[model samples]
Target: MLFSFIQSHDQNHIALRSNDHEITYGALLRQIDDYCARLTDVDVLGLALDNTIEWLLWDLAALKTETVCVPIPPFFTRQQIDHTIARAGITHMLSPAGLQATGQSASPTIPRGTAKITFTSGTTGTPKGVCLPASAMENVAHSIHTMLGNDFAGTHVCVLPLAILLENVAGVYSGLVAGCTIVLPQLGDFDANYSSLHHHLKQNAATSAIMVPELMRALLLQVIKQGPLPDLKFLAIGGSRVDPHLIKQARNLGLPVYEGYGLSECASVVSMNVPGHDRIGTTGSLLPHVQASITDGEIVIHHPGFLGYLGETAPGHHLTGDLGHMDEDGFVHVTGRCKNVLITSMGRNISPEWPESVLLAQPGIYQTIVYGDGDPHLSALIVPTGPHADVSACIASANETLPDYARIKHFRIVAPFTVENECLTGTGRPRRKNILQQYLSPLAVKETPMNFYDQLVAQTAIARAELYRVPQLVDGLQGRISRPTYIAYLTEAYHHVKHTVPFLMAMGSRLPDEKRWLHKAIIEYLDEEEGHEEWILNDIAAAGGDKDAARKAAPNLETQVMVAYNYDYITRKNPVGFLGMVFMLESTSTQIASMGADAVMNGLDLPKSAFTYLFSHGSLDIEHMKFFEKTVNQITDPADQAAIIEVATNTFRLFANLFGAIPHVSEVRDVA
Candidate 1:
């Protein structure tokens, strides 16, 4: 039934494409038959194969053998893989290496018609297997075929992993049934890197594709920068709530993105918005085969759906655990997950998704998660549209539309969440528990202690204060500094500041488990230090120097050695010692650099823009020194303390040497 096109039309018609190879309908069916003969004894199989013709062949072979197949997501952790293997009672697994018998047949007991076992995202805990009949998944495909009408027959690119249920059912099965060629590229080719993905889509002349909201945002940015992807006619997006404003933006850019909603238990898609029957924001009306209703704000699906969770009894009805409603025209509008609802300390109930949608719709917001379960007011963790985006203004715009209780009272900008970091689910849902535990406490409180540790750190800083007064540095600064001397100073600063974030990242990564308390501080430091090197380049341009030449310039010997030595110290020796570099730099800035900015500015008669780096560091280091003191004070071990002091003294000596190396430019030479 799946390959009916082989009988009705040309058997040599291409069905699947990967790299430069194409599999025709005749070849695909023959491969499936060959695989079924080899795996006749296997009742249950697991697929850990990448996106390729082999993955599809194995899946079709399992269907022909009436065997239950489990498609394992490549992104799953080892622990999760083990859980799925044991729970699904997988007898064999097909991977890139080849098919191997798992020797794990604990329990094969499932509903009589079980064809595939799909797993949930497992954000909160262990993922539960949803056993679906072959017919149920096929039903979704048929409904999507009918929904799309004549527009269904075209090249469909599988942007999401095949293991994702949305792709498995709506993308693959639907495309196959409609007799459309499906392109399954390696997952890495299309993920995160938007420019490459857009290029691939254009090169392949992709007519339709499936994308998550995050990828859509990236593509939106790409389209805005580049031109439209005219060949890409249909884009089905789901897996998380989509921002309507993002949808609006995409439409304006000529991108054909349609929002839909589904879950594993529903056999992938329950509703979709097609060409004629479209709703801009809401997920379109439920497909013909399924029925849905809002029972006390919870989306309840009435259908003979999944058989049961693995090793568990089946429930009568599937409560999606999602709070949503049906609109006047039968479209399903989802707010957020029921479990994610927050009740304020004053007994004010709020759905974070409602306010979050408003926030994300604002121009600067790229990502946000709202929180206020027992707090006085709502707050959020935000990632802005770009490094220099005005998130505060976005928050202000979002607040104007929200009620007092639901509005964000405060928020902090954080690094973007991604699958590689385990902060986002495979399908782009935030792991709320992980995010809140890692960030909420640190962002909510000022964690610096004020005890003996603080006093000891203060004493250490005081002892190193004289490092700012090296004779060559003091004499050069005390006199009127010339243009060339100032330019040399900036060039060296660029060489070192360019490594600041990378070095901090290395230090943070290498820090021991006992140093867990310092992780938040390190991330905070990363946020501040990420692009300071660019400021130096801007200053060079403002000073009428060749910014391009300065960017390509090599670091002076002293500066290179200082950076190289500290990198070695962090990696080979104690990581805590690297903080000594911070102490040397910030202490010098706080003591002399702040005043030095004005002195050099007046002496050189350069614009204020020329001193962006110096002036920023001057004021910025005052607060940074305070944070550094608190962070260093928390180094309780005597061994750690000694390392910090030794490194600090050595770093000071290096700084003094770097200053001495810069050629003094007298005023007559500078003017000439």
Candidate 2:
């Protein structure tokens, strides 16, 4: 059916574009025929390539031959890749390098009529294969093309990975069905560099593109920075719930933006918003190919074009697991996931996405996940826009729009969830289980019961390992040293230490009213840190290095960035976060400062005066850590704890860079 649409189009019309290469319908069809001929003996084909002309050709060829095509997402971990190969019983694999045999020829028992298997990396580490039929996929594509009409039948740029079902069926297949030229840019070329991506789109005169909310946000920002793409007629945003305000913002700026909803089980798109029949808050009207109704507050799709899982029997109907409803105008309004709905202790059920979307609409709040399944009130883990974000005010403003029970009572400022951390799905949805395991306790009802100090210690263990792994720190611990390298370390240390008192003073002055108790500790820190830079200069002088030169030397780029980060972190972010730097410095001093001093001194035969700063800090920080731990234990606010943890994590990373930038013993020897 898809091939017929392609074949019926003008044979000379450009069908695919990647970089500078273009393939007309005639050439595309010929290439697909050649690919189909080669796949005659193959039972299952694993397609693993970036967005390119060849990827589309191979995909269409697989569809033509009725081969069980498995599109492997590049972002899948090695374990996931291996699992997919074995689970799909893949016989041949096609990657950027070339097609190769996987050595496995066993035919897996998938659902009958399955033409393609797309893996969805859900809330877990492992990805599950969703078996789809060619007819079902074609139906969805045809419906999308029909709904979008001829206005969208122009250049359609592929903004997302072709491996994703949403981009595959709704974007590429639908564009082909509409006889639109498909532009296949390398996913990485524009994934992070939105400016280049928008430029590519403008250069191609792209009229339509499919994007997730995250990508849409980036592109919108880019458009604001540069200017709107004049040729763009349709931009469909999906993969996760989008803030309606974002859609409104895009339209107000004259960028055509629409929100849609779909899942892997439905062959990608079940409903969408188009140009004339547009609605802001809803997921838009249902597509012509699928029928949806609310059953038991869960969206149920009848004959949803789904075949079944790889090994499971096909169900009569698909229970979408998404809770939503169709309004009088036939638009679908998705509330949230049925399983993700939180039942408070008072028995009031609330969807976390409700307050979460509201929170996200605020200026400073970037990403948030709300939780309080069996607790009295809701809490959230929020990733602020930047260090200067006033998250308190943002949360307060978001609360004004939500019911009291669903209002966020407590929130922790944390790092952004990423696919690398396995805390977020590839589609930008938070893996609630993984996030809760990493941030909250196992039960997911409340914050971890551990004290703030203990939690900090537990959370930063991996970062500490990374810090310890720096070559300089490792070699220094093992007694590998040079006199010049030691002096270089002292030079950088002097530069950063000079700012210690100022950082403390700034932190003390910026403490919020509720954290007034921390002011005394900050004052004590200021007094202890006042002359620490002079000690490093004295150590430099005793070590036979020019103390005056060391005192006036500029800090290395890494050291300068670290100092700037701390200052910015103290002034812009939560002042309490500065304790993270103290925790890192003092705790590290107590652990390794004395031992490293002894190793360097004995190895280089330096005088005891040369070790004054290290020796004093080694012993002095022990009592300081005791005081620090006691003070941090008194902090019960979730936001404060989150700030400290985030800063400590960043401090460990930046400090590692600082140590890494120091002149290594081997480098100095080579230089000499």
Candidate 3:
């Protein structure tokens, strides 16, 4: 009932492409079957395998024994490795003579046949191991073949650490199942024999590969250095949402990175972005036999092949902390991580992601992060795409149409983003909190004078801005531990980031359809999200470098709120209010504009590069809100309209009142 797949004949084909070497699936399976026969009595197999071809063989061999395989991440510290080795009762370990992402050397941690413990990463750094039935890994391998096409074995390349589930399945098992060749390169030789890496990619007629965002970024940078790559057919990039701009750039450069969505617990490959089946930003449609739904914005999964957790929290189901929503077409689109969501004291729940993501969507901003949950404001940390370019123009360009609250206030430039170092995890996934603690927060908050945009907001200079609003919760308030004042009264307010939007939509509490229509129209009209950073630059260029001047001219918070209150009155408090009204006008319009202006003043080209982020949403969201108003008003039935107005007005009033009192919360001191 859980965790399984069947074998395919495609297994005789070339399976792996690495280090200028190749091993057919037939050869790979032969080796595995032989090893499995040897390990018939061994239960668990500890794979210390980095990313390589032998790792593939060993993985296959372990599976043939039906043993539960514990693949470790390359980034795990030696201490972590040992903790898991000891805890899991491993009798065997597999590793290369020299640890490497490539497959060239072979050193099974347990000389071939001994039962060994394998460890999976844990939150507390403790290792968890499951008893493996001899056919366990093979069962998983079979399922992989059933999924990726049994057509002549395809060339598979390892992009993530081989230790990751995605790579192990796609790079090893899939190839073995297809009867394809597997490749492995020597250790620590990527740069020196880098051509071998590219050669492996091209020579095996590399048709399939698995990559995390960081690897994609690395490859993208390599292409930027060496012009486009040749022969690569299918590339799966996931572990998180990729920069939309990077996606656009990759396609332009002839590198089609198919985005897939899955987690370690799902046995990987739940949803994949396949050619002709690609949805640029969407994680692509869910695969056959798997069930997925938006539970409070978080992805709840049910799969026929689900694994039993180390300690069975639930049966055949797992709630992945990744936040996402399904499109009307059934495509899965990831918004961000569930834990990544941060709600401020304001009644308004801000998706730092929705806005901050816009920065990465910007052309020159290679990487960008938005932060602020307990703090009074939102801030950004950025990494540039080019060498020594001004960021002001880019920021100014982005702010043109942004609302106030969502606009970035403080900013800092940082190093390029990567997953190789401890900066990123083995799967090429980012540990945002870790990043904040280690690199971002300490430097950004350093006594630097607040930027002009921050100065404007903190001082409440906008027309509708309240100079010193009292927060509903200030003294000793943070985290879910505290009773949420705004959320408590709203009754309908979200309990977790994952559920808020969907929950609101569920009780007939959705953003008005008209607003949705308007948003779609605006996005299409501006061709937004197509190369957002470039869009921002183009918009800023059109605006004539007076981005700050424009902000200075834009209506203040007071003015916008006046507009809102006036609009609210005209509508007689329609309960079916548009989310854009709160999202765009109140938040994006002022804050984004202010941020752009500040960046412009600070001599950065960020404004020009940030246009799509600010203007697209600002313009579209407002239109959406207006459409919502129209939709609410069209109900001539007085009762219905009256009811709608009551809900809208009440929601709006609560929103305003709660937000109005939020500017005064005490800074959160620690993680609760």
Steric overlap count per candidate: 0, 0, 104
- Model 2, 1-672: lDDT tens digits are 888899999999999988879999988889999989989888889998988888888888889989889999878888999999999899999997899999987455687788999999888888898899998899999999889898779989998889998989999999989999999888778644355766777778888999877677667655544444778899998877776766765775457988899988889999999989989999999999788789988999998777888788778889989999999999999989988999999999998888888777664677888999999999999888666355665676677667898888787777788888888887678899888778775544443244567668757766775786677876565345688888999999999889889888888889878888888888888888889899999999999999999987788999999999999988888989999999999877765674577766766778999988888988699889889989999888889899998999899899999999998863221210
lDDT scores for all predictions? Answer: 0.78, 0.83, 0.50
Decreasing lDDT order of the candidates: 2, 1, 3
* Residue lDDT tens for model 1, 216-247: 87777655444457787899989878767668
RMSD (Cα, Å) of model 1: 16.9
- Candidate 1 residue spans exceeding 4 A from truth: 191-195, 442-672
Tens-digit per-residue lDDT, 334-450, candidate 3: 877666777765645676666655565444566676777876666777777675233443444344335766666667776655544345544434557666776654445452354
Looking at model 3, residue 345 earns an lDDT score of 54
Candidate 3 at residue 623, lDDT? 59
Worst 10 residues of 3 by lDDT: 473-482
Off by over 4 Å in 3: 1-13, 16-22, 96-153, 191-200, 312-314, 385-389, 393-404, 415-423, 439-672
